[model samples]
Target: MGFKLESREASMNGVALIDDEGRWTLLHTTGERPQASPQIVASNSPSRDGAFVPEVRQPLGAVDMVLRFHVSARGGAASDDPRYVRDVNLAELTRVMRLGRISTMGLVIGGVPCVQRCVVSTSSSGEELSENIVPAAFLVKLLDGFWSAPLGEDRVAGFLRAAEGGSGPVSPVWRIEGPCQGFRAVTVDGVVCEWAGRVDVGQAAIVSGWQSWTVPASLDEWWVHPSAVSTVNVSDSSPVLPDFSGSYAVDVFVDGVKQTLATTKVSAYCGQTFI
Candidate 1:
């Protein structure tokens, strides 16, 4: 049960919200349960007289989270000190939280960690709970509304296999290594994106080349010499969103064969992280 905060400001970078000898002690945390952005009801969408119209749902929007901290003066400080120390700590807390752009909040409970981006909201670092203690809290607004499993959690690096269950469709950063003919990656969500044409690495034996197929962005600057037969294209429905975890069916045609290797890697941003 620990909370760590990282922000662009040097004063707040990699700071532990709770520390044994520090003034800021994390007391508790709270977050709003995920909800749709908002509902929109069409005016004339087959609604009976004076009856309710069918509403449409947008995806989850920003969420507000609270990080409560107990800012206290040092009990064992020599002389009646800490008066200066505590005030400085409070000032640091206020500036660190409110002055930054977007901060990354990381929480680890039961040895499992999850991360989310947040901006400090209005309610923060104000109330004094007692003589020597102030119950200061940083109210964080999560604009993206999704907690992402960090780049190094439960990740297997050689193939495109996402362990499903995300707030929505997560587009992974696909790395395509080659000496191959073409490549294709299909999300379990039914989103089909593939590339065609040969990866020309000259007539060298056991040679391999690499390219990263960025999601949605689809940058083609990664390849060279290989004729641009085609890039990763969407052929079917509204892209795809897989309902289950596991492999979403991927193929890298190496000499007209299937895939998997250590030299080659695919960072499947798999698994769901909740806080």
Candidate 2:
């Protein structure tokens, strides 16, 4: 059978249950008609906050999710205390077929978990400003079947070797920060940076699978390809090399960004003296 996933909003204040195959069964507690407790709560598309409520898709057995709610302490009470407490015992409930395996589950407010019954005591008697102190909800997410690959020691050595002896205008700069995983490409300005093979291709996979990236050094005038090597004109009037007394300079590009490395000019000097 195909994997099933679904999410249902807890109605009023009740527990929403789901099975391994992703089916909904709501347990409602009527105020007066407790004997006629319905096995399946009425399906109503309640709007949550500003979003329409719908069944959420989830991976089975994942623990990255939780149930959510909105709740707070009611005002005008002698003490800061919640209007009512919603009881939930998942570990026990699941053992008794009351709850299903899901990634995460929690009652949360303002992105934080709301535990047990939110209570307002004498310590917060005059602090509340609202009549209805409904606390925010808990959300549950399941986390299972997640997989990741690890990097190898050889991969590090391979990358280091490549950086130490790479040929090009760009040099391998010692890593200062990172080359995170899932990064498919990198650009300096608008130009894509090409990977120079110093490390074995196997090592490259290690970096990719492990989420590490390499740092590169700047390159000066150097041979790129037979048709595209950078060059400097020594006899040109504009003096390519500014600062000191260097005669000529070559421009370099890394990942399409211009490099600041300087290259010495190779030109013949000529001057005529008058007697």
Candidate 3:
């Protein structure tokens, strides 16, 4: 009846399938399996010595999932015809697989409920006459690799507030929920950085979702230090300061509406030893 999968804590789980029109179907499944296959891209060039070495160009690719289920054929004694039950259930599955262009899939992995958008890549059904049941399988793919946080509306709002406060001493670290394009972090002093990293929530749904971003913590070599304090002394006497920290702002657009979080006071501290 609800919109999530039911499972025992710390054990393998099953998935609940929902159609585009919000219709739900709980599969009578024996096992649920999800696999991740990443594509490897490589290139090779001849060296001066004429030996060719392969160079990896692209490493990651889309993930594909295969779901298996066991269909039951049981009814009241009067209408308990095994073949009839199998036909009806098979037809129902066919309708779900065809009409549901984009659907919501729910499953639990390591006691965490994962929900995401998915489309059926392939599916098949076969009749097991001896067992008087039907066996069904589906291959689905995720559009992204992030999982939606299982937080309520109130909790989500609170999380956004804390993330805007930032994480590290120099720059603020922000935990962002996705189903959006991208995000930007800026400080009161005009320090800005664009986030472009991925977080692996899990493989239950196999799609991408929201991500967390920290300013100086995740800067690495990709980010260029702001011009204002690019030449500050950061030796033992003083540590290199993060360009953006307290009183910062995070901007993101969700469902065509721009959402912004502004924090009041953020502080940075330096550890020192007086000999």
Candidate 4:
């Protein structure tokens, strides 16, 4: 069969999943779920003040896609094929499918534009015509779970939830230049997180990933998630979706911290992994 669709699109390594070439047509895509579980158990030492439910963050497991397309043998696209040139296009699709994650894979999805790093796990294709066309599909594991907008700082709404999470702003991925005693970041969505560690001029601090953060050139240079000290939970009252961005400038208060978005996108999509 054929899919009559528009307004939604996806790509891998810059190849459009849906295009006018008639080589491939995206039918349906599922598995954009961000599997974020909290770190409460990671450091679950409730000192009474720690009694709050820790933010649960996990990772998006995998995504499965269904597609249909047509091809011709003499078109120089693929091997000999009939049924209105179905297998020919299937062969053309093999290149995109074979593109492994290691070779700088680029995944951009969403109606508004979100990017992620992903690798195909498994896929299948053939000339089993469902209606004068080939039916096929693939499964991929998004390495970073949540998708971050590729460029443009002002569009990220601080968190990456799902494709239908509405039109949010770009992720405020940033870095803090030193000379500032303490740094505090409040996302466009207002999920606040802070760090008491001081940064000397020349050193910079940032939330590297969902795992741990660092302050380069600092003596202790020791690391912490910071969300552990004072942070928000999976179901923090202020928001609906989980803040997998872990862009931790949380709902906690630390005296004398700099609140700035100048460094945003400075680190280029630092720790904006969202749910």
TM-score of each: 0.58, 0.18, 0.42, 0.53
**Tens digits of per-residue lDDT for model 4, 1-275:** 34453323666667776655655666544434445333343334555543445453233344433333333223433444355465656666766756455322333443345566667666776656553356566665555545564332221233322222333222333344565444444544554334445446666545433222335534232233243322221112222233333223222222353333433322323222233
Per-residue C-alpha lDDT of model 2 across residues 1-275, encoded as one tens digit per residue: 12122334222123334323222222222011101111232454554334332232222232222332222221223453333211122222233322333222222222222222111111101222233322222232222222111111111111122112111111111111122212111222221112222222122211211122322222221112122211221111111111122111233222234333132111111111000
- RMSD (Å) of each candidate, 1 decimal: 8.5, 26.1, 16.2, 9.1
Worst 10 residues of 1 by lDDT: 202-211
Judging by TM-score, tell me the better candidate of 3 and 4: 4
- Residues forming the 10-long window of minimal summed lDDT in candidate 2: 266-275
**Clash counts for all predictions:** 7, 65, 11, 26
Q: Ranking by lDDT, best first?
A: 1, 4, 3, 2
Backbone clash pairs in model 4 (N, Cα, C under 3 Å; residues 3+ apart or in different chains), count: 26
**Deviation in angstroms for 63 in model 2?**
16
**lDDT for predicted candidate 4 compared with the true structure:** 0.43
Best by lDDT: 1
Top-TM-score structure, candidate number: 1
User: Which scores greater on lDDT, model 1 or model 3?
Assistant: 1
Model 1 spans with C-alpha error above 4 angstroms: 1-12, 29-60, 81-84, 98-100, 125-127, 152-169, 179-182, 201-275
What TM-score does structure 3 among the candidates reach?
0.42
Runs off by more than 4 Å, candidate 4: 1-7, 28-85, 99-110, 130-132, 151-173, 185-275
lDDT (Cα atoms) of all candidates against the true structure: 0.46, 0.22, 0.36, 0.43
